[model samples]
Target: MDRTARILQDLYDSEINFTIATFWHAGFQIKLGLGDEVNGFDATGTADNLVDAVEWLRVQAIKKYPESVFATNYRR
Candidate 1:
């Protein structure tokens, strides 16, 4: 697979949403998210919005990583 696909797959495996910025010849940025259940990112970029997806992911992550620190940051 390519770099973008690999990165996306990794995010999916981790069950975390991500904000990725892609650059073009002029270095443009495009952010994308992977998870539907977790507000993996604080930015406005979202891949999909399944009902109760964010809540479900939050519960799962809380159970899986009790001591982990996870939050969404929307500052650019």
Candidate 2:
């Protein structure tokens, strides 16, 4: 599967409630929901809080995955 899909799968597998905001025609980004915070890396390449990790993924989507659509305010 693609990176985004893989990441989403991983997140779900970890029992975390991941919220995905899709940017059609581009790539999609995922954010971890409340109480789903696990002290580990997520599918979005995060190694801590899902918020931080998803933000990192958004950055990566913009920089690395140019064609990828992502969410805004990855920092917070």
Candidate 3:
């Protein structure tokens, strides 16, 4: 799979909900939605590459779910 697909799979495996959009000249836009509607935290960021996008998502996930395994076991 491509890097972006791999990144998305990792997020799925980690039980993180996300959406990624690509723009011709603007790189990638990543949005991660965590938890339920009423108490959820949503994080959005733009990156020039998939790796950075996932890293940003990881940081946000950790911030919202400090006790989650995602904090320690997230893959690069």
Candidate 4:
């Protein structure tokens, strides 16, 4: 598969739940949601590339849930 497909597959396989939207002529936006039903948080990141967008969202997720499995596994 191509790089974009691979990255998307990896994201889908991860525990983190997210949605991505593409702008007409701007770029891309990703909205990532973390935490359980009782406690939840949402973060949005926009970038010209998917990698940058995911990285931005990942940083936000790590900051909010430093001890979470997603953060721990992401570091490795």
Candidate 5:
């Protein structure tokens, strides 16, 4: 897996209050969450293209971590 893929996998698998891999819909900075309250990141860069990143992540996750989607949704 590539670096980006690894980060996103970690995010989907996270159990912490703050996961740095949690990115808002932008370039890639980091999404902040206090308990169940999350704040959007003010991202700016080439890395924050989440629309494309999400599809890539979903594909990789389905292949490697099929159960992660449930975990991800539960986190919401």
Candidate 6:
């Protein structure tokens, strides 16, 4: 599967309850929705690979919504 699809599958498998899932190789942007809304990391970023992209999401989840229980089982 593609990057975005694969990522979404990971979220679904974990029951993350995210409504938004976007990733782009161009600057490696990522946007995720959870906990009823989104407030931070709502922009594009640069990632060297899938691993970096996943890490970015995790970090952003912590930064934007630290109280949330965000987890991604996707491995690069």
Candidate of highest TM-score? 3
Better of 2 and 6 by TM-score: 6
Worst 10 residues of 3 by lDDT: 67-76
Superior candidate under TM-score, 3 versus 6: 3
Candidate 6: tens digits of C-alpha lDDT, residues 1-76: 9665665566555454443344554545455544444554343455766667666665654555554434323322
Tell me the lDDT of candidate 6.
0.52
Scored by CA lDDT, what does every candidate get?
A: 0.39, 0.45, 0.71, 0.66, 0.42, 0.52
Error at 42, model 1, angstroms:
1.6
Clashing pairs in 3: none
* Weakest 10 consecutive residues of candidate 4 by summed lDDT: 32-41
Top lDDT prediction, candidate number? 3
Q: Give lDDT tens digits, candidate 2, residues 1-76.
A: 8655665564455444555555555455554432434653234432344445555544544443333323222222
Model 1, which residues run further than 4 Å from truth?
Answer: 18-41, 45-76
Worst 10 residues of 5 by lDDT: 39-48
Give the runs in model 2 whose Cα sits over 4 Å from its true position.
21-30, 34-76
Using TM-score as the yardstick, the better of models 2 and 4 is 4
Q: Give all TM-scores, in the order shown.
A: 0.29, 0.33, 0.66, 0.62, 0.28, 0.45
Order by TM-score, highest first: 3, 4, 6, 2, 1, 5
* Model 6: residue 17 alpha-carbon error in angstroms: 7.9
Candidate 5: how large is its RMSD? 10.9
Instruction: Quote model 2's TM-score.
Output: 0.33
Candidate 3 accuracy as lDDT: 0.71
How much lDDT does candidate 4 score?
0.66
Q: Which stretches of candidate 6 lie over 4 Å from their true place?
A: 1-27, 34-41, 71-76
Clash totals for all candidate models: 2, 2, 0, 0, 3, 0
TM-score of 1: 0.29
Residues 1-76 of candidate 5 have per-residue lDDT tens digits of 8755655556555532222343355454333222443553222123356555444444433444345543454332
